[model samples]
Target: MKNNFYDQNIHYQFPETFWWGSAASGPQTEGAALIDGRKQSIWDYWYSVEPERFHNRVGPEHTSDFYHRFKEDIKLMKETGHNSFRTSIQWSRLIPDGFGEVNEKAVAFYNSVIDEMLANDIEPFVNLYHFDMPMCMQEKGGWESREVVDGFVNYAETCFRLFGGRVKYWFTFNEPIVPVEAGYLYNLHYPNVTDFKRAATVTHHTIVAHARAVEAFKKLNLAGKIGIILNLTPSYPRSQESGDVAAAHISNLFFNRSFLDPVTKGEYPSDLVELLKERNLLPAVEAGDMEVIRNNPVDLLGVNYYQPRRVKARKEPEPENAPFMPEHLFDPYIMPGRKINPHRGWEICEEVIYDIMVDLRDHYGNIPFFISENGMGVEGEEKFRNEEVVIEDDYRIEFVKEHLKWVHKGIQEGANCLGYHIWTFMDNWSWTNSYKNRYGLVEVDLKNGLKRTIKKSGRWYKQLAVNNGF
Candidate 1:
């Protein structure tokens, strides 16, 4: 059945050099635990202790098995019109102890993957860390300790010396803020501590580590660009009321500016610093740190836009003398009427991508950027499976097209936007959610030992790449 929904006139053409690909992480996709000298990460430890917390009791071991299947998976990348592909290096796999002695098997495996990607005409964008710190490092305070920062520098330097010639695009970290919030404050990740102070400390150390890694990459003179992938959530006030606007600004400062200012501008926002200081929650910083951060600016920025945050002034005050929370300064309010992703429960607000790019250009001097991750995760995807191995995922197709349109708008408006890479290439295990949320263009059949089946969206995306648009 030919389904032609997007009018050709409405589709905007992309540049010839635009990156058409998908992104995945080592922890989320690779599932060869205890194989080829790979060591356990924080995730491996967490799932072992509490398998019940994961959906379907599936742990890190049941991912897409990319560790053993990269050769086959790279073939799928070529089939799916991926001229470029992004994947992360597992920290534990590279440096099992988080510092010394590179695992020769891990190095050989990554070299094979990179070589395969190059052979298939797929540009490999490799990220250094993706929320998979080795268990040894976590036991010794993880990102909170300065020693971990030094270890990270060593690990990054090792990668540059080993694979720098082949891998051209290097990313320092992917969404560093998530760990601070989820692990340290919200109790969602490993070493789950509900201490705001630790969260602040971890966040600071991560930035410092990023700066150190960038410094190491430059010192080693690696022949590539080094950048960080940030999940940018543009915040909007619920109404035009002054209080509502103020609330939105604070939310933006905490979530966006907190990282952006330090990475791009070399300092944290004064207002955010003041707010934290007033609440006695400022991060500890040493002299010369600001200089290092300022001097080592990123070459590019990866924007991962999923949804916009609609915020308003808190309707009620926190319990008298309660601990500080983001909500203490602002409240997230649901807009009365907006398009929503029923499959994933995320608001389908495409315009936010454009707004975010504009904000970046207006505030951050228009550094070259790309949509690093964007995709829709649907539940119960098997229902749409056809006999020919096709899954009618029109919703996913629509999600990509809508977001690309706004991304095109940003490019046209001088946003220095480079390209768009979807969140995933195939259905792999998600953290906590496991495989419940399917964001892949290719569906993985878990019951059948992770059989790969390309979905309807994959075919649609291929044509989009072939034509540069719909």
Candidate 2:
């Protein structure tokens, strides 16, 4: 939270081979949601049924229209000094039926997008899923059903065979735990189930799907590295007391290590497993699921750090008839004087990124990783527009600079960190919240036909990319 985290006098040059770019997803950016053989995803279905849940009643059907304007967008990416970019392939678009023939038009569109990026000298980092499940698959018990897992594996294999030759950085899932938490636990996403047991199954099956996809990617002998993107929020105890520390430990087990350990270390944290077993909330794992997860570990990792989680020992007893939840083990501890993002209501603890890097270096073999998604999403950013019609978003530039300083320090300390990609390249649609908070280097004016204008941060980012530092 200190303003002195970034010393302007220091020339923090990154490696020459560092990737410089940002990330966006198909579901959030690509419009033409139901066109050219595209089918409905969970977002589409949820919007149709409960449009009121979305901000201003806006749905996913008409996003930033990336489908039609990708060529223009790639040009903007180049203008902003993007050498590498990450985005997801919509499963519903690629395989509309979820278990049937591929959609050739969708194939043509994605191929064009990838080819366009290649032509623009931009490397494409394609993710397989981004919380966008096909409605048909969701109808078939979603992630709870093993059949859906097999279908997802098939879909991933199809993508590998189709686009693996050009795209060298592939991600199996973007924040796989988000769906498990949002849809199953928090009721923030579609199917709005609040059952912890069901949530456990969903989480397990998602890991199974990821491992199977990694297995498939390796089997294909593709010229690409496959991994998963995880949003890791490091948990901090309110105090160093034994009870509070134990609470933080359990919090880490549920939120961070549950996925991190299995994908990287090839198994779940033993204590996490024991905890779940003791609660009778363990997911149904098949005989060879563990082997699949163990044998096929990710070749790379994409970390998205936004904030740290503060926790303390639970002070309240759970009612006997209450549904079980992770919150039962700990209570959220709001640290006094902690910096907060008023727009998003998230704490701003920039040092957590360095802590994450050091932890990975010490405990997780220092696996090759990158800052996959980091940015500040501000509401009513138009208020910051200058006379030049550019958003003078100095705050975003400071946010990136501060985080990158910690990233540079981590690299200096021998963390195998590779690159940093902001949360998005352009302002695009977000889930439920829609475009309520703008987080982009380039501004997309939805009121003006999604007009694309480079923000001041975009200019700064270009210089940062060119200089390999700020």
Candidate 3:
């Protein structure tokens, strides 16, 4: 394999249609929570309700302040060679109550941002939700209740009708599994509740909501594409042993195919459904829900690949017949001598990106795809500051380059991927972890009132974008 790091000629130039961009969410980067008639999201409520849970007790107010500084930030986007950008429209900002009259200020703010991106030759790919539910909606049962699904569909339709023409690519939700696991099952997000039943229900409802949004988009006959963003964690076995392979298969079925099957293949993985049914934990579904999911398939898929899971057969007995855990059938085991990202404790298996794309091509058909989010999070990146206080983050550059190689491999092997957008464009607020995990190409100086500085990786990305290869 030719190393693209230095061998520029051997590195394949990206397609002319490639989208060079970065991604941020409304809640993560857009501060000024209460400004311009914006209401409170679950993050806002979480900060108020449990301040201690956040890193350094720094609440949502301490984000990059993109709400007020978008005009300036758009300049930064242009400078970074971002011909396209992805951002979410905050539901609370638009419909303060989660489902009612739209806030004019919020609408105007988003319009300004979208128009600015277009004016600057940047395509705006708008995502509907990014894990920030309105406080009002969370109190009313969040995704666990059917009402939230209707509310989300309404919110999605509103955005589509409002900005469908300008924004060519519309994503229904960003990593819908994260909210289901973090909020309802694992207690990492707002309205944190550790109930498997609720988690299962939320997962089911989120898929339904995504389908409903797709259905709505089809009805609108918009001249754009709509899809859902999934964090695809490819599962690998510890060995070729049947038990290990089975464990890995079940793990893939639980995480990857759980959503992929329905969205792409238009049906849930039978093994996963059977496992849940055997434990009597299958989410209650109305007769028409399955039809909605099966009928409205995605036009594209945004894959966020960060890590892979290595699994082994479960040795321990089930916990007193408790609700079914994927671990009950498969245990996550670290592969020996695998590369690890010591900064974030995530195993670094770059080949997983290629494998995932291949799997999608083989199982789910060759749907248009994008590497919507892929980046490393380093802790205390400020320590790299030199005499000039500039961040020289070479590790992040290497991280992106290695991943891009596999992306190139996937493209060469017939994966219908369209583009790649790093996990973030700049450092901003991350839920629970807050700003501690810096995954941005640009370093944000929180102490200096959220100042931005393009890191070494950002400069490298700019060149890559300009040259269409490293």
User: Of the candidates shown, which would achieve the greatest TM-score relative to the real structure?
Assistant: 2
Sort every candidate by TM-score, greatest first.
2, 1, 3
Q: What does candidate 3's lDDT look like per residue over 48-140, in tens digits?
A: 989999988988864888888898888888777788899999999899988999998988899999999999999998999999999899888
Q: What residue pairs are clashing in model 2? A: none
Top lDDT prediction, candidate number: 2
In order of lDDT, best first, we have 2, 1, 3
Two-way lDDT contest, 1 vs 3, winner? 1
Candidate 1 local lDDT, 1-470, one digit each (tens): 44343336636888889999999999899889778888899889999999898888889975899988999999998888899999999989988988788899998999999999999999999898898989999878898888988899889888888999988899999998899888987889888888877888998899988988888888977678989999988889989999999999999987888888888888889999898998899989999788889888898888888998889988897555876778787888988888888877899899899999998899899988899999999999999888886898998998998889888988888998878899899998898899998999888998898899889998888887777776
- Candidate 2 wrong stretches, greater than 4 Å: 1-10
Clash counts for the predictions, in order? 0, 0, 0
Which candidate would rank higher by lDDT, 1 or 2? 2
Candidate 3 residue-pair clash tally? 0
Pairs that clash in candidate 3: none
RMSD of each: 2.6, 3.6, 2.8
lDDT over C-alpha atoms for residue 408 of model 3: 90
